[model samples]
Target: MTRITSERHTDILNGYKSGGSRFNEWSREMLGDFTLLKWGWGALSMRWDIDDRFIMPDGVMFGGHIASVADHVAGLVAMTVLTDSKERFRTSRLETNYFRPLTAPVAMIEAKVTNASKTLIHVEADFVNGDEKLAVRINAVQVRRMTG
Candidate 1:
């Protein structure tokens, strides 16, 4: 694991702030239209426009798609704590629980880092439907690594 200095952490966080809408091509392809609502030291919030493509034949958003979005947002929150560009993290454990079916065309995802260490980060995210009801919850553990 790479040691993250306080200065380095601040720099990385500032970079994220300046670089708005950090979604890459892969993220766009996977999740479609989304807006980064807020970002901080160990938290991230986003709003996504759920289209018909993500809906199941039963008229609810697919569970896998919700999980994917949760994973992506959790990863972004974890990256804010990284000190080095060479340092990377992978989701070692990801658990998602669906509280209710998502029938709305919009979703609000909020992810926050519960705990972070040199080697691991624990994050939790909530998926809320347009009705402001909890639709799904995700808990994830990301393992950090240093690469040359």
Candidate 2:
């Protein structure tokens, strides 16, 4: 279990250059102003500064934004189990449950790979608010693929 620092994350991103500009940009947007707090074997923790743009008119974070963060982080956790440079994972199914409204200025996200097989990987993510309450939970399955 190795801690993934910000520099390590940058190295990993640079090592995996398969994703084109579109994918990279999308990931960046989903993880806006995020800090990698810690990471080990198949688990990672991150903190995201919630932007005012993501807040809805009712003053709560939008559900879609939450879902996107889960999906992106889940994929990153799945990548931790990859054994080959050609291996890639894509979310095939994602289910998100909102337990409470997210009005916090920041979000703490934790993602871990629960199970994995030759072709599929299961991941779970939790989004916690500033009050340390669970705001959202996400379960996802990622399909593994090989690239030439």
Q: What TM-score does candidate 2 reach? A: 0.82
How displaced is residue 86 in candidate 2, in Å? 0.6
Q: What is the alpha-carbon lDDT for the whole of candidate 2?
A: 0.78
Per TM-score, the best of the predicted structures is 1
> What is the lDDT for 124 in model 1?
93
Local distance difference test, candidate 1: 0.79
User: Model 1, residue 147: displacement in angstroms?
Assistant: 1.3
The 10-residue segment with the lowest total lDDT in model 1 = 16-25
What's the residue-level lDDT of 71 in candidate 1?
A: 83
Residues 63-148, model 2: lDDT tens digits: 98888878888887887777666777789999999999887489888899998788999999999998999999999999999888
Cα displacement (Å) at residue 107, model 2: 0.9
- Tell me the tens digit of each residue's lDDT in model 1 across 28-121: 6777566667777778888888888788988998888888888887888888777776778999999999999887588888889999988999
Best by lDDT: 1
Candidate 2: where is the Cα deviation over 4 Å? 1-10, 13-31
